[model samples]
Target chain A: EAGVAQSPRYKIIEKRQSVAFWCNPISGHATLYWYQQILGQGPKLLIQFQNNGVVDDSQLPKDRFSAERLKGVDSTLKIQPAKLEDSAVYLCASSFGRTGGKETQYFGPGTRLLVL
Target chain B: SQKIEQNSEALNIQEGKTATLTCNYTNYSPAYLQWYRQDPGRGPVFLLLIRENEKEKRKERLKVTFDTTLKQSLFHITASQPADSATYLCALGSDSWGKLQFGAGTQVVVTP
Candidate 1:
């Protein structure tokens, strides 16, 4: 089976500019996740989607960040009016929802966003 | 608030040795903790997971121990190889919601 897929492996944008990242989860996976990893830091969960419905997004910056999982198979994360601190790598992961508690997450290659 | 801490400095170890990494957390009790291996320019790959009820779990050369009283987890790789060089991240499943909270990660360099 194919792994989780993410697009635009690298991106660079000026502060205050808008950027968007996309993710396509593994086949038959019912749970999708988006995480942000700053340099020298671990990935922080941004949002989670369980088959088209959001499971958690408490850490998401609603003022500047937005995410959606249309139809539940693919997801997108967007940052508008970006800040310099927003420069980080964004990762996408997927797992089966039924046994998610014990299942391991399969991560994508990730998208590196550089906010200049 | 819950916070996870791991060694920030990179660890250098000769190949064939056992490399052990530590993960300590504060403020929250987790039901399960996980380890993931991340290489430069790529996302992390899951290595192991241990629950609070379980004291230890092993797979191949990898071993993980969870100590609830100490709020710490130990990850060990025996007979390590150069290919095992990577940043190892420790994560916990949130008690309230079971979401994953990750640590900064510990970098291990295995020299052949």
Candidate 2:
């Protein structure tokens, strides 16, 4: 089976510019997730979507970061007025069930973003 | 706040030897803990998961031991190979819906 898919494997933008990342989860998967991984660090959860509705976004920087999963199959994460600290790899992951802890998550290749 | 920590240093081991990695957490009572393998320029791949009730789980040559009393998890790779070289991440989750907190990861290098 195909794994999660993401667009624009790499991106570069200047500070204060805006950047967007896209994710298409695995077929039939019910849960989608977005994570940010800074260099030499683990991926940090940004937001989670369970079939078009948000399950959790407590870590999301609501002031500048936003994400949406309109159809429950694909999702997008956007960061406006990017800062140098925002340079990191954006990962998208998916799991089969809504009760997620037990299921294995399939991850995409990730989009590596660099802010100048 | 809950914090997860893995050894930031790299583990260098000779092929055919066993490599062990550790994950420690504080201020978190996780129901389940997971391990993932990440290579350079790539996202992490799920390796194993162990629940609080379970003491040990094994897959192939990999073994994971979870000690809730100590708030620690140990991962062992037996018969290690060069292909096993990668960063290993530890994640903790409390709720059933799977919101997770991750550690920075420990890098392992196996040399032939």
Could you give the C-alpha RMSD of every candidate to the true structure, in order shown?
Answer: 1.3, 0.8
Model 1 over residues B1-112: C-alpha lDDT tens digits?
A: 8899999999999999999999999998888999999999999999998988999999999999999999999999999999999999999984433478899999999999
TM-score of chain A of each: 0.97, 0.97
Candidate 2: residue A58 lDDT (0-100):
92
Task: Give the per-residue lDDT of model 2 (tens digit) for B1-112.
Answer: 7888899999999999999999999999999999999999998999999999999999999999999999999999999999999999999988878777889999999999
Stretches off by above 4 angstroms in model 1 are B95-98
Highest DockQ scorer: 2
Top candidate on TM-score is 2
Which CAPRI tier for candidate 1? medium
The digit string of per-residue lDDT tens for model 2 on A10-105 reads 999999999999999999998999999999989999998888999999999999999999888999999998999999999999998656467688
